[model samples]
Target chain A: MPFHPACHSYEPVTIADRLFLDLRRAILEGELPAGKKISEPELASIYGVSRGSLREAISKLENCNLVTRRPNIGARIVNFSIDQLMEIYQIREAMEGMAARLAAKNMTEAELAHLKSLVARHKDSLLHTERPAKTDYSQDADVDFHFCIIQGSKNQRLLTMLCQDLYDLVRFYRMRLSPAFSSTAMQEHELIVQALERRDGEMAELLMRYHVRASRDRAKQRLESMSPEELGSHH
Target chain B: MPFHPACHSYEPVTIADRLFLDLRRAILEGELPAGKKISEPELASIYGVSRGSLREAISKLENCNLVTRRPNIGARIVNFSIDQLMEIYQIREAMEGMAARLAAKNMTEAELAHLKSLVARHKDSLLHTERPAKTDYSQDADVDFHFCIIQGSKNQRLLTMLCQDLYDLVRFYRMRLSPAFSSTAMQEHELIVQALERRDGEMAELLMRYHVRASRDRAKQRLESMSPEELGSHH
Candidate 1:
């Protein structure tokens, strides 16, 4: 099977892989809570696993950038800040922009058609929803849109870097910033799809970069408007 | 101290970290050889460390993209491939392009001066060397030049992604493809430096992307000219 550019698609095969997925979900969903120190023994006992399995799981988490491990200090969940979020967007703007460009040149006609249908479905859903911003579906569909383009790039290294290493962090932030979707963002997605349909790599990259940068600015505005307590509160 | 965008700058503080560093050097220097299956028992005995420490070190290598671990097949050193090298260059073109743009706006005056001096030194070294292409000094200087700009971008996450995650693979390729340097690459560096000096982020990004793309083309040409045996040899 071709690799998909979303962490949710990863199938866990081993004990450590299962545990990593569970802990990853917990962190992204805010169930474990951000910036919390990991207690290896406590977690192992709670999960009815050995320390070795838990350590292995935590190492996987660290690879995903969901957990930070220091030499002397133990692992801590990644803390959120607007600055860090902006930094992430900066990366997305570059990497995803490249992905879009590659996809334009490389995506099969069937893939492009699939992408168009996906965007159309998203638009339909947004139009039908009573409160599109309040629904989690919009957020998920947004992720799917980005994932399709990234996977279409046909660059395995770029796919692994974005999907496995970075998208978990993206989900972590998106969970906190629920209701981040907007009609403007949808419009941007439509434009990107159009560029891809035309097979204009340059235009596709430009649109993707613009879309990511606009999202960053919107996220910054939303984050700035929130009080510290509001921003800190786990959803 | 600021985090430098080079893995060699990392200080190994723990046993596992030390092992990781040692093993990383082994892989990049081709002492371990490319595409070799890692034997935990053998490696642990050779390093005089426990299997657990060796496993930890291997895990670190996986994160650096130097090793690939399959569920049931075990870990193997990443095999060299022209296609994979091209993929990496595409990523670098996007990311390092963004780095140049950010550095133009974010780099301090001192950093700019330091960069200017770095280019001057590299140029001087190139002029004085009898066979500049064969010397490792040029490669190191080339790495340093890119590192300076990536560090100057002042994006901590970008620094980590490039330095910790991607550059090792870059070094792996460079080790096999040494004598890849040319005066053209240096001239490209000079243009990027000038753009940064003028604080022109757009121009800096344009020049940086062009440089990476050109380097990719050059590497492709050199690889094509080599015999399959020559390309596969672990230099």
Candidate 2:
């Protein structure tokens, strides 16, 4: 029998698939630090892959906005300036606002319950840490909370755009976010969850938008406070 | 002197750049109809390009969701089902909604006046067309209207995502939009402009979101009314 590819199902993975994820993770975690010049030969050898495989990965990363390549010159990791990061936050406000609205109607009772618990846990942590700025919560946990709400939106396209397309860039931003940013974020999350429980989609969406904008302001202020000398591209 | 790549500016373009735009135009215009299998060799021959160049173009197209490649399975033009189209509308709602909000705040007096004339011209055409449904106004004008508002948002990242990344797909949807959809859209555009004139960002955003969602419903209802026997994959 002839093997016909399924209309909706994806085919098997290739080197480009794996390398794209690996390179993306490295960049997000600052392993391949921003503003660093990427030597294709070095990466190909380091990853134990061919130049062809590495180039493909580079192309995919470029598409994902994680890396940028110049003709004749070469590729470099994307360096987000303070302004660019704030622009990202503005986009996030719109995206997550819609996500919260959808989640209000789509989230299951059990999902709502888990979200409640997640916020409560964060609130407890906020209370316990006398100097909340000194206690660094797991970035993954923070990621999970936002991701959970996004998943609850049940919009596959939205999921792909947010959780997949913008994943690395958002991760990079959140990873560098100061611990002091958490308490307010936690409070906002609690209110968002409460609105979701009541199926108040409008309120939930508005609050989520406000939450993201507030976070952006905090991030911008923090970055601004850093003396120009210390806010180097590599760091 | 150290050769440093600019963080915000993109690097130079190559063959992939030209072909991606060419092929995208062909696809959105339905010259490369939806559900058509993409043969690299055929496309290469058609465009007088090498296989290597063609593949790069294909990769770019896939990234834009204009085409879908399934590893071992081949690539095909993205064939949107009604549900998928609705999903696209939801995403557009969020993005254009944010865009309208920002545009309301940022558009200069001259920009707002130009926008006024644009909608006025469309209204004139709409009134003149005999059946209106048969005349088919230029899709480029429609694109410019949205692109203008998106530009007014003045958010580079949002601009890239809307204009650069999701561009072709959005164009495809707009190109297929029935002319019957024009009258109401024109009227709504007028209202949105009025809101912008008043500098009511919130109302402008809401109207824009509603406009997009209303368009989606009309498209959905039209598609649904067609019989399953008419539901060819190509259609």
Candidate 3:
């Protein structure tokens, strides 16, 4: 049937969907560790939902690769192998590069101004203290900067696909931003902004690719220092 | 839950899965056009499967975005808006470009040999056939060449994500190839192969991006000449 916008627009939120969203948030925030089994009955009771609703939520999670489901077995949180991580980064590098290129050509004046403000705010935050007690604001600003560029691309399909793949990994990337790294990222963002200002699509794309690769390198270095068990820990 | 290898190494195929695969193939092949509502009871009876099995299959299809499901309503194949089509091509250009670059660095000798053979076969087919007939084989060869590059990238995540997005539209692209266009595509593929052979990653990536943009331009030209209804007919 056609999506009957009326039905989708005002219908009361379903228990299954609510559960799915909550579970997804937990996974993305690293509250649900990798390799942990998620029991349906346990979740159903905790969420005050029926087993059927819980199963539906689990199915959606499985589709997102946030959870794995085996017939006659049970669900567990997903863990990426080294190869999978590498593959994910490779895809991200290309998609983000494209986003930067398009943003260079298509960003509206208002959007470009907003991006500049975001970068300025981040720079101010870095100067305020050697290390802030709360990194959430800075992180949010960082996300906004990237999100603006992706949205400025005016490519909703690419944005949707990349967001789905990258959401759960955002925290991992965020944790790698040390004071020194944050300074470097700020400088990189300035170059990206300059390229966008000049409408230099190729330079913008190259810079964005380099930024992502640099982040990936930092993440890899961090992972290399951790024990296997520590690396497997979600938080 | 991790994927469990089936006991006994093999088991009788389930009717539900068979129906699901058949339906998926039909959708991908454009036999079941986008925006067509799927009747569950009718499909169940036609496929000789239970209604429950049909529902399960529909759920999987919905996840793939091949079909859209509304609560308490039903499912229909998804149709892309013009904006969505443009966005899709933008993502494809980036992904195919990255795949070409990685393929240049990573293609095995055996895979390169296989790609050469495909090109040779298409050339042989061209020598004996008329314009349109020759074009058909040549387009098939183009698809195979791109597929080989994606495979050679050794990035499963990139391949899987791109496969999901491009599976249906590739048919539209294939249908638009003309004999003249095919010859040009062959020459482009030859240049891509030469870049790969020389391990010139930047050249390979640049050529692939240009090739995709050229294809997109052709698609846009064809789309401009056609009415909305005619475009819908292709789906």
Candidate 4:
């Protein structure tokens, strides 16, 4: 999940907020499937919410670019095209690179140690397994590592744009490409953490940018290999 | 205006949409100074719209991050701090850099020529001026040059994110800082155009990135030069 630490509340969110969060996660994770039409009444029934609340929630989703709504045709999950996917990678490389640089300067000693531990844990899992490829470097762990650096940047605008505006659009590509980069990815992650540990902003930013660009290139290759129809529901 | 040709209307938008657009522009341009409170009834009467429509418009602005809404206090225009201003620059460098790289590959011959002409026009303005330092380097012209390259990227995601999601947040800082970089900025712009003409993606990306980063550093220095109170309403 894309973390928003500030969104935590002492008072609970409304029924509409809950519905929006659930619907957003489902759509972003592709469980709801891209390009699937939403019948408002049907979804209202499914979520056990009033149609009005669901409509409000859906409007928010549309604002977030998670949904595309037409007057008569209704709403569908957005499918990004391969070109758009590569564009996202380019932007990510820039933003995440800055995040790494800031994190190098801003992260506490404890956070650096935590990052190192996470990388070590992943490497340990790989070594102990007979088939390292089957060990499945967990996506959650990877996201956690990145999220920590992102949050550590302490730049609210950067954090919001990356986590809220851009993260979901890439979930599909990430799911498809994440597991494929294992051993090399581990070395990249560890080196990035080491740069932060040294508080070397330049190296940290360079490594992070390189990592994101590499991933983007790999994603480009994968998408080029696919037919447009198969990448469907890609907006 | 940050053009979104797709956001153009086949059918005219509702009253709420009109109000939202007007209010968003006013807030972003600093016409309605940041941290100024919004009174629903006051704005409703000012806009000659119903309270319901005004409220809807305010909610949309809140979603756009041009305004902040609190339960008891109502809404106020967003005021970004110097740190937040620098944060936005870091992002623009990353996104705009990639846009330049993509534009090198994607821009039509005609588009490249047009970009070159725009740069030539700016240079001519500098040479003919009585006081080159006081010559008005039109922000509109500057925006047009950048906007063309961004759109020429043909990466809809990058275009939308840069144009829609991020551009206006930096306007105040940009308007304040833009003049300082005029002559050299003209040189940088021309060099970038030359790279695009040569279809050199790497050089174009590098030059464009350096341009953005230089602007950012200048903006940062300006903000740092200001006293907290002088910066005013910086949140």
**Which prediction has the highest DockQ against the true structure?**
1
| Number of the predicted model whose lDDT against the real structure is largest | 1
- Please write out the lDDT profile of model 4 over residues B49-154, one tens digit for every residue: 9987787677667666777776455788877677777778777887788889989999998887887888778777777875636446556677778988988887
CA deviation > 4 Å runs, candidate 4: A2-12, A29-31, A70-73, A129-137, A172-181, A220-235, B2-12, B70-73, B131-137, B174-181, B224-232
Scored by CA lDDT, what does every candidate get?
Answer: 0.86, 0.76, 0.72, 0.76
DockQ for every prediction shown: 0.80, 0.62, 0.62, 0.53
lDDT per residue (tens digit) for residues B35-92 in model 3: 8888988988988888877877777676556787777677888776655666777888
Candidate 4 or 1, higher TM-score: 1
Q: What is the TM-score of chain A in candidate 4?
A: 0.86
**Candidate that beats the other on DockQ, 3 or 4, i.e. the better one:** 3
In the order shown, the candidates' Cα RMSDs to the true structure are 2.7, 5.9, 5.2, 3.5
Better of 2 and 4 by lDDT: 2
lDDT of 1 by residue, A158-212 (tens): 8889987777887888777647689999999999999998999999999999999
Winner of 1 and 2 under lDDT: 1
Q: What is the lDDT for B131 in model 3?
A: 61
Task: Estimate, for each residue in B6-108, the C-alpha lDDT of model 1 and write its tens digit.
Answer: 4344677888889988888898888988999998889999999999988888888888889989876789999968898999999999999999999999999
Span of 10 residues, lowest total lDDT, candidate 1 chain A: A1-10
Ranked by lDDT, the better of candidates 2 and 3 is: 2
